[model samples]
Target chain A: MNKYRIVIEPGSENSNYWKDLWNYRGLFYFLAWRDILVRYKQTVIGILWSVLRPLITIVVFTIVFNKLGNFPSDSGAPYAIMVCAGMLPWQFFSSAFSEAANSLIANSNLLTKVYFPRLIVPASTVIVSIIDFLISFVILIGLFFFYHFIPDWRILFLPLFLLLATLTAMGFGLFIAALNVQYRDFRYVIPFIVQFGLYISPIGFSSTIIYNNANIPDYLKFIYALNPMVGVIDGFRWCILGGSSHLHIPQFIASVGISILFLFIGIWYFRKMEKSFADVI
Target chain B: MRNPIITVENISKSYILKHQNNERYTALRDVITNTAKSIFTKQTIINNSKEEFWALKDISFEINQGDRVGIIGRNGAGKSTLLKVLSRIVAPTKGRITIDGRIASLLEVGTGFHPELSGRENIFLNGSILGMSKKEIKNKFDEIVDFSGVEKFLDTPVKRYSSGMYVRLAFAVAAHLEPEILIVDEVLAVGDAEFQKKCLGKMKDVSSEGRTVLFVSHNMGAISALCSTSIILNKGKIEFNGSVDKAVKIYHNIQTTNKNQVYTSQGINKEIFISETYLKNSENENTLAFSHDEPVYVVIKFYANILLDDLLLSISVSDFEDRKIFSSEVLISKVLSVDKKFGEAILEIPSVFLIPNDYKLNVGIHIPNLQVFDFIENICSFSIVDNGSEFSKYVGTDIGCVFSQSKWAII
Candidate 1:
């Protein structure tokens, strides 16, 4: 029996938007759980796909980069293990961005019929991706044992960077999701972006390849960090490669700054577009 | 008047309808071509190709704390748009509204029901979608299960359930919501007769509990039975707002003038098409209003592109609620041989054997009563008034259909 006076005027923004989001947190939780459950509900292998998907990427990257392209691993770490660490964050980002971008259109029925904070749809989609990230974390541990290369104290900083990566994905995701509702051409653009992202990110090879390679220039390295995934992949490798790998400070700071910037811009753009979702979607 | 629970002030909603384009989504290539074309041409192609449509226009009303207000309107009359604005699913383009207490809307049954989820899981899911918390759902969980009568398959996926069971379960969960202001649309039309009755009874129970209810339905019978006051919309404007009887009366007379009398079968088979239809009384005056017991003629002027064989025409009359009250003969009609392509058929009634009410005509063409060639439903309507006949004098309770003669015996 929560009682409050509600006033609706044309072009009036709900001042209690953030508060209402908290009130509808139960819906957010339920929607995320529903998506996760429905995702694997009919599949025979069930949750195994979460693990197998990432594992396949790890093997493909290891062969293509280490064996074929003659890429070096971080010191004593096996190439596969190094690739797994980088693949985890990259996979989480790409999937989170792609799924979040499609979330509003995918739930068009709910958008048209019900009223809640429209932010919950894209936010819940990101949570489903986070669930996938947690499931794939299991394979990362098994990879560690197979290579017998234990991460050091730097691994304790993993949670901090993981939050950063989530924010980066979610920020860009909100912006893209807003645009997708108005123009479905983003549907075709999304897969191409995700595919192009995989090559630019240091998922298969090490970020230090740009650092040590004599042919690459220093200024280009700064531009490389602008990709955001460069710093995250490098940070993941630093934590897993332990004392042998060095985390670059200037690049890491730039990634964090850009992620925060995008997060704010994403929130602003998403809020502006959220009001028109029912009309356009 | 002093303590109204909901107050709406001059609300209007408009939408811009864009012209149809091959590419609905603007790609980079489209943007480039459009820009180059604009540079070469004098006028830009963005603004002129759109048309503004008003779905709701300057609608204002108020509801007392316990008023069970019914919004009765035809399709495209802004009923759904008003509901959406009340539910805050979409914002109005103009005006203001003030609402006291929590408002919950059942716009559609099973709004968020996932087919992959179990019935038990979907209950909780749908409950939260209707703005119920987990603790609230837990408290009513057993009541919902008992009401739905799907305990035997609670753990099974809802996709496996029949459409009846799915809607039943969904309605059961939504019925448990305890929000103080309830907004319900035409959701009861989905379930079967008994379930629909049950839902109506439940809605009555909810209204009697002192909650303000806003109900929207096209069923005039249900509206008159449940709601005392009604709001009628016509062409995005409120035509009437008063007692349920008056609103239903206005709605019954609203359809005939707006619908087409001359239906064309374009892009359809042209073997036979009815070009025109009208009514003529014994006085030979063509009109839609008639007096009881007067002889009436329904004229159908048709054109045949080719020789149509075994052509049969059937006509039926239905009351305001769309119930078929009376119809012409169901048997195959006598085949008529016409020498000309254009001919007219007339079904003459000796006397208007109908109750004093408004009724719609449904005309159809068939081949020897086997296959229907062309059919039009509720194409036109007319009102029959009592003209001081003995048939209209006996008014105790014999108002089904009028017959000129009847025998009554008193022993």
Candidate 2:
């Protein structure tokens, strides 16, 4: 008798999930590349859309917040450079979330007809979004040269912030994607969440604006820092602008903790609901 | 002499179906009212009115290393659900299935192909979906394209290929990406007859190489030709698990007996009514038994109170599970010849084409020209059974369905 048995037990989630995913790594790459090709194909502007999207947002934010609201920029650094830094990570998170939320529903044909790791669907969407992030990062570098801003040694922490943003985006993306499969109303809710989230996160202004305005209570500021994006945006500006807006240890810890929490909850909720995806989708 | 390669123990799957008629909201107001009601009274809070159905109930079977197994059943009999569980696409509500070797399934043709991607790219994409490594897919790329006969269209996106070309390519990719066990579910029905034959030959070759094959199809001819052993599924349970010939016989017998009954239904608006429908042999009497060369007639009797225009009568011949094998439709004005007070339509099917196995007839009435009448769906069914004939010579006893009569000369 063969020692290894591939048994499918109903109503029981497989314990060896990591092994199964490792085996399906090829599918992950296929889906990711497929997404990349489909998005770029037949478009007049082609890959420029990736850069143009974030650059346009940076322009709108720079005008509205810096000129109208009189928000402070990182000391001596141009407002465009400061906003572009925040927009890069924020665009990565929002695009990843939107695409991941719709991944399973969009691939209903593949899910119902074939068997591979269901996680590969959402995971591949995140990877596709990462490709878009790399494309848009080039635009960020151009803005850095135009503004003549030089980064400090703290810029070494950029990779940590990128990882933090990716994890946070994936966590939320998995949760919403799983929910959208069941409720379908999540499709409508996602755009609103992305739009609403843009205002709350420090994209156009530095966190110092909120702190210098003393009308807000101290405890409220502490709770506001718990939003996770607060720490991420502040950290990006500190690292890129080369200023005293150093990494705040407590807020960074809170952001990392919340990201991990969301990741665990997302995976659990996704696995629980995955069984019904084929039937309903 | 070999140990079993696949073992299934008491596997069962149940599905919950939410009734569409019941409208319950999960809104805050509704939740609050329901909570208040539950707090005030000693009663269950939620309504458990949705129906639960067991798709597979306590089914168990085993297949040896080199065995070719066929699963046959009527629609809703859980054949596809069983395959889904076996492929690990969906988990069963209960029971377990264990297989020793790598299993590749072609549950549906072109399962992972992107319409925008060229056939060449899709081959690699689909190969990976079937669990082939990149190097393995590269090695077999030429053979896959040759077998599918889509080498010229390899650079064209699959969406541009004709449906026949699409299925041929999809099946070719699946067949060449060799796995220890192969599971195919009724995919052969999509392609032309010659491609289907090639697919059947490939499946036979695979089984002969000491690999296991699990096939689910309504085509009894294909099943009998390829499978050494067969199982009959009836309403989510295994009815018979034995030699291919015996299981096919049981399946045909069940279909024949069930199709002999007449069907009729009445509605408030009596624009049309289904009176009687049945299947009969050439003797012009309703019977389940049929001869090899005899004509199988589908007789339908219907009534229309007012003078009807553009009324269409359609008939389909399907296997036990309602998968359409062949269908035809006739307009009333074209076939009626004269306006009649009452109507009877008969569809004749010539034999020698359908392999000897159980078959069902589905009758439909529609008003394609008028657009005013409610389309009557498959209103009735009947069966055909084949008598002993020489057409069965090339076929083994295990083979089911029609054996095409073709002559071969040593040229």
lDDT per residue as tens, model 1, B57-112? 99999988888899988999999999999999999999999998899999999998
Best by DockQ: 1
Candidate 2 CAPRI assessment class: acceptable
The number of clashing residue pairs in each candidate reads 0, 6
RMSD of each: 11.0, 11.7
Question: For model 1, how does the per-residue alpha-carbon lDDT over A1-281 read when each residue is reduced to its tens digit?
Answer: 12678989877789999999998999999999999889988789999998999999899889998999998888668899899989999999999999988999899999999999988998998888888999999988998788776788999999887888888898888988998888788888889989998988889888777877788888888788888888788888887778778887888888778888888998899999888889977
Give one digit per residue, the lDDT tens place, for model 2 in B213-315.
Answer: 9999887767777889999999999999998866765787687564535666553586665567776777777655555557777777776666656777777
Question: Worst ten-residue run, lDDT, model 2 chain B?
Answer: B20-29
Local distance difference test, candidate 1: 0.82
Worst 10 contiguous positions by lDDT, candidate 1 chain B: B388-397
